[model samples]
Target chain A: MKASPMVEIKNLKKWFPMKSGFKSKSNLKAVDGVDLHIYGGETLGLVGESGCGKTTIGRTLIKIYEPTDGEFLYRGGDSSEGGVDIFSLSESKMRPFRREIQMVFQDPYASLNPRITVHDIISEGLRVHSMGKSREERKSMIAGILEKVGLRPEYMYRYPHEFSGGQRQRIGIARSMILNPGLVICDEPVSALDVSVQAQVINLLEDLKHDFGLTYLFIAHDLAVVKHICDRISVMYLGRIVETAETDQLFDNPLHPYTSGLLSSIPVPNPHMRKIGKREIVKGDIPSPVDPPETCRFVKRCPRAFDRCCKESPSLREVSDGHFVSCFLYD
Target chain B: MPKFFYKRKLDEIEEKARPVHINSYRQLVWTKFKSHKLALFGAVVLIGVAFFTLLGPLFVEVGYEDMDFSNLFSPPLTEGHPFGTDELGHDVLVRVMYGGRISLFVGFASAVITTLIGTIVGLLSGFYGGIVDRLLMRFVDVMLSIPMFPILITLTLVFGSGIMNIILVLTVFGWMGVSRLVRGLVLSIRETEYVMSARAMGVRNGRIILRHVLPNVIPIVIVSATLNMSYAILAESSLSYLGLGIQPPMPSWGNMLQRAMNYILGTTTGTNPWWLTVFPGFFIFITVLNVNFLGDGLRDALDPKFVSES
Candidate 1:
């Protein structure tokens, strides 16, 4: 990255307790020992299969869920800044930290409030963090942001119910960007949307990044969508990053068998890369987060597993200058 | 499974012409409700009775408790009194109208207050989901354990009977059930993606609870409040009938019933004079029913949980 690292994840772990009513919970490691660097003005895509803990990683980095163990450092120098190990800070201390980071969620239908007018929905972040000094300032700022997201200023008075799904997702974007956050986690932002609208939103995101100098940890399962937008991509499996490489490098020659399998599975019409007669069909569902294997998690599904793979959980080693992978094959 | 399948098919056929938003829930309910022949008749009868009772007495001169012993029991359609005189010689028509106003007032007032209080408590408890929830829900549980009749009687015995006092008690405990309702609503709504987005935006607790959570709970609250009004009105009348609700001279619907009970019992209560009990009883029934219809229609119109009307 040309720019400095805006956010750093150092051995981050998030374990959710598996419990029922009045029952003691067993620890379930949802995000286990994830280390990553997201630099300023860069989009880092965290791609994974379902339940691979990509979403958990996003939530934990923002302190929505405290890490079980690890350090999350913010770039600010404020009293609430510079990585006091967010898990140790009081909730009030975490308040101002919220202004720096925001999230745009998947499911546009579920992300923008139905009862709220587009105005209140968009202006909410501005009002909460005390961004604008006066009502007119807030209004103009809200209108400006709405227009930035491809919405008419007049539609501010209308409730969310009046808008289409894509429009609502735009409003959701407007709400998050009203504060012009430094870091925004777009969690599967286009999955719920139709294919055509997806391109518009992705383009909007790209334009917004250029305008606002934003950094993103775009989490999604579809590598095809993430391929163009992300500067670097980390492919995860069962709560751990299996491979990390620059987007082009990862796409051109995926080394990890899991990454290779994921890339091979993409139903694209690329003629040259086509393996018409061969498909890497991964066996078995993702292993449960509860009581994960002591060895390499990919061992069970790996077609290339060996004796050493069963005895050791591979460390994320730098295979090339910036490329990292966690596989015995690399060692 | 087949029954559900057939019903689902019928719903699909009905849903075909329906708009995507409305077709899912609101329109389906509305079309089904509209098709119900008896509910429609009940709805009309209810509206007519409420219109005449609630609006009819606004034109009369006599006060609700006005008395003139000389004209007592002069019979129905009598001159100077269309509904004739009661045992107290008061104009029964005027009395029932005013009583209707009072009954509707108490019922509506109690229901509204209850819904508001319940919604606030519910949102806080359900959305917060920790010590706050524990304390607030424990309070609700404590309130719920108290028996309705005994509490009303004790309150009447201790604080004395009047409209405001009765409304206060009704609202106090009336909020319990709807609190549970709204809490359940907020529980579901808080987990919704919109709420998550709001939280991610650094939106404060109060704004999220009010804007995102509260609106989602409106359908449930409206439906519950509408039902609660019927209960409130019935409870008030029952209290008055037991001589503990509105004291003598206020002439509540329940007090009206209490006075007419003797006459009905003495005359087998089936005689044409039965209009006394019948009219007041009919007013209570219709007011409750109309409030229900209003709730139903509002549910169809404003409920967001129901699929958007295509």
Candidate 2:
């Protein structure tokens, strides 16, 4: 592992102002004060339920949605001392950084523009960044990338609608990878694919990561898929990271109550072991993120809630080597 | 599964299956448009009419101002007067051909101007939502609320009636509908994932609007422009009928109709000059109808989901 992290997020906040009625305004704290680090050449899976600000974090990191507050520092390659804060950079100043970071979207169908051919879609980034010198050079580069992503080079001239879900996903992958970005924010890339196709895409992604030496902030809701690909995992609940550990360590000895509950919900493949395995399903709906109380976000849904869980929120603390948890039980 | 054998077989199969030519976006739209039979017919008819009117004047020797008092009220096929002569002994065929030039010019020019203004305003308003959108939409609403014909008449009267002044008046009121339509379309398109993806790629805002949003908007703008052209023609006709558009001897289709209406109740000779009114009115009707058909065809052809086979 490298001594320095490739990217470090410090106290990130993204609050969207909501209009309730006339003369009253409140903010929905979508991603409130998230602190994280993504090291070089490793997939860090961000596992969370729907609307837990997982996608928001990914978007904010790439400057898709500007952060309400905090620092997003990108330290490219081995030399880490001279990294710039992404949040403070102006749009023109940030253009070059955009070439270094790319994203694969959730929906394959919606991601590619319908009117344009696959060649145009893949070449868009190259055109913007002025990667290839000439049109023919860009065409060859696009063809090469298409083959790398497992799509035929001949498929470049076809429109997006001509392809199936899996093929379109490959095109989406090709589009992002063509830029040779250092860090890829794969925001639910496989969530919208078929169960059978998911494995293929996952393997493709894994192969590409090794081939390109790319780091990934893999945001997903599926723990099983995340465990397969991610080197380390971070469990988020309501815009806050509750636990961070190695994939096997997090799954085998889950520390936070929320993390354990998530792990238990994954169905076991063996019927014989199912009866023996205990399911610690948490109770109650996720609390509204709009002006949430200062108490622990998981207190209402925690299976082992205590007096301290309601009165005060617990910040993440290291309990074991390479494992951190936020629940008061560990404290 | 040997590498050489597998690669050779795959290459052979791919070569056999590959299409000979790749279709560009324009080619696809043209192919789809050609499939719509009615629109194709309309296009042919419109082209024929345009060519005849625009070029027919060159062949005809009779000028619009050349009045023959001796050949007054002469019906169709009467030496040198094929369609007929009007109360002023002016050749109706020459007059109709000349008038078409004015009417068609007004329609095409106004449509182009309105579409340009509407598209620019709508693109800006829709892409930059918030105060800009609210302010633009409200201004559109204010423009829409004003009575169209009354303002058109007032403006025409103020500017003095001519081809340019009438077109100017029509354009001022005409752009509002197209802007509203384009804004609605842009609002939806701006939220699409492709646009967001483009933004994430750090494609500049102007480039995104032009390359991404504008292409999607063009189909709608084209259809609306066709509709606007027909509307402009009719508006011109109505204003001229009321003696407020394209005044007198310059002979527009509208003013021609205005002059024909004077002889509808029969002239001093007790002869009904129905030929005078029928020819100009028929031209207007055909032009508008075909323009509409062309618009309908374009809408279907431009739709990305429209299957050419269907």
Among the numbered candidates, top lDDT falls to: 2
Worst lDDT 10-window in candidate 1 chain A: A76-85
TM-score of chain B of 1: 0.77
| Clashes in predicted model 2 | 0
- DockQ for each model: 0.23, 0.33
The clash count of every prediction, one per candidate, is 8, 0
The regions of model 1 sitting more than 4 angstroms off are A2-4, A20-24, A76-93, A268-273, A276-278, B1-72, B87-90, B258-270, B290-310
For residues A1-331, what per-residue lDDT tens digits would candidate 1 score against the true structure? 5545677778988998777678676779899999888887789999989998998888777766767898876675333445455556666777666777888888888777776667777777777777777766666676677678898666666667778889988988888887767788899999888989999999999999888788899999877789979999999988888899899999987879899888888886778867786667688889888968789999989989999999989989999978999999989
Residue B133 lDDT in model 1? 96
| Residue B69 local lDDT, model 2 | 94
lDDT of 2 by residue, A206-292 (tens): 999998889999999998899999999999999899999989999989999899889888988998888464789987778899999
